[model samples]
Target: MLNMLGISAGIAVAAYGEARFDAFGVMLQLVTITAEATRLVLIQILLTGATPPPAPAPAQADRDVEMGLLGGESSASRPVMKPQPGS
Candidate 1:
């Protein structure tokens, strides 16, 4: 028999690691890091940026996305969409 198991790890990880896995956040991070690392290497192997890199933004910035998923009606304090008369 084929069985599927749904562990809470994914949910927990997503909740905790939103910045790294989120599209708007870390999707570009991999690409950018690679380029920066390569450029730094080319220019000077020992060169390093003095200032720290900016903090990564969460892919799912709004917690409402997870909250609103219970149904079409979103309970998030911040409305992702304008409230319409009806669906």
Candidate 2:
């Protein structure tokens, strides 16, 4: 809301400051800005509504070995040796 107001004020200031203001040219500029804003908004909407691509499935063998889920020895079960007292 604040940004829109700032943009509107800026455009108004620019148009008002023009020494030789042409009504037709000003109108054209306003229309162009409106069209560009609309185009950007539509592009944003389309992009946000778009669906992402499907992810590929893992191999059957790879799936079975996942974290010992199938009752097999998993990498997580490996024992780690602690360092001796001194160094």
Candidate 3:
């Protein structure tokens, strides 16, 4: 709320300065004021504890592999390979 007020005040001052001085300095001051207000608003939002969206659910294949590993089950019931004496 205070940020909004500050921005409004800055705009009013800039308008007055433009009417009186008609110089580039007033435009620069207005830009600086706008930038500061934006920075303050961002900081206020951060302080208010904004959070990111939740992650997506795991895929079906990934869930199944996880469950199998936890349950001590092999992916396939195949015989173990043995080494030959010579190639």
Cα distance off (Å), candidate 2, residue 75:
62
The most accurate candidate by TM-score is 2
| Residue range 18-46, candidate 3, lDDT tens digits | 68875587789899999999999899889
- Kindly list the per-residue Cα lDDT of model 1 for residues 28-73, writing each as its tens digit: 8888999999987766744553555675446443444555675544
lDDT of 2 by residue, 35-60 (tens): 99999988997988965676545664
Cα lDDT of all candidates, in order?
0.61, 0.79, 0.78
Q: So what's the TM-score on candidate 1?
A: 0.26
TM-scores vs. true structure, each candidate:
0.26, 0.36, 0.35
Flag clash pairs in model 1. none
Model 3, which residues run further than 4 Å from truth? Answer: 1-20, 52-87
The list of candidate 1 runs beyond 4 A from truth reads 1-21, 45-87
How badly does each model clash, as a count of residue pairs? 0, 0, 0
